[model samples]
Target: MTHKDILLVEDNPDDVELTRLAFEEANVANRMVVAGDGAEALDYLFARGKHAGRDASQLPAIVLLDLNLPKLDGREVLQAIRGNPATRDLPVIVLTTSAEPFDVEASYALGVNSYIQKPVDFEQFVWAVRQVGLYWLVLNHPRVA
Candidate 1:
């Protein structure tokens, strides 16, 4: 988190590998850390549980969160993040396979920075990942011009 890694909160192993490969193919330099469940994701962000003693102040540059997850789910995680002042300003993007209107609307309502439906095609998915990484990590600078 201190290095501004891209935190990917996903339970599906295949999706995790695909995203890692996509980011690699896209040549994104930022490291990606995986949290297999919502509770684990929160633990990492708050530096609790197994991630204890880690500095909580240095959060990830961005989070790619999946909605369907075990142990708390993405909505709960997002709520916890937004509710805490320490992580309220963190940029969180909902990257899920779900394209349901409710999911999209709810994510925005929960203060998500972006809602992206995981593209079915590999090439398209890679492109999406590349654009996302480029925009968030390089082109867009919230603190500096």
Candidate 2:
């Protein structure tokens, strides 16, 4: 059986490494496609730029997006995803450090499926990642493409 990859759109190296470790701790071994910034995430999703040759039809199980990013912000990326017909229905979860109500409201308006604040503690972070992985990859039934 093949495991569906998780699309992680983040710029911070430490956060990226922590996420990897968290997933590993949770036993979620699915391959992770890490995009350093929002523009690169868009490229991967739309099969443009360096990802032009990738199979655009096979979107990841879910997208874990960070709001603060370079090249393009997560809000723009979320808008792009929702605007495009092909990726409109894809599950996108906002995983960010921001606890601002405005940010939460804005993300929801942009069509994020869920909004989760990053856990500061490693154990809590690992548990959160595990739950998200299980729910999105296993329990949640996305619409058939």
lDDT (C-alpha) at residue 52 in model 1: 99
Q: How do the residues 1-145 of candidate 2 rate in per-residue lDDT, one tens digit apiece? A: 8987899999999999999999999999799999999999999999999999999998999999999999999999999999999999999999999999999999999999999999999999999999999899889999987
Model 1 scores worst on lDDT over the 10 consecutive residues at: 136-145
Instruction: Name model 2 segments beyond 4 Å from true.
Output: none
Tens-place lDDT per residue, model 1, 34-141, is 999999999999999999988998788899999999998999999999999888888899999999999999999999999999999999999999999998887877
lDDT of 2: 0.96
Model 2 steric clash pairs: none
Give the C-alpha miss distance for residue 118 in model 2, angstroms. 0.3
* Winning candidate number (lDDT): 2
Alpha carbon lDDT at 87, candidate 2: 95
Candidate 1 CA-lDDT value: 0.93
- Worst window of 10 by summed lDDT in candidate 2: 136-145
Candidate 1, residue 18: Cα displacement in angstroms equals 0.3
Error of 2 at 3 (Å): 1.5
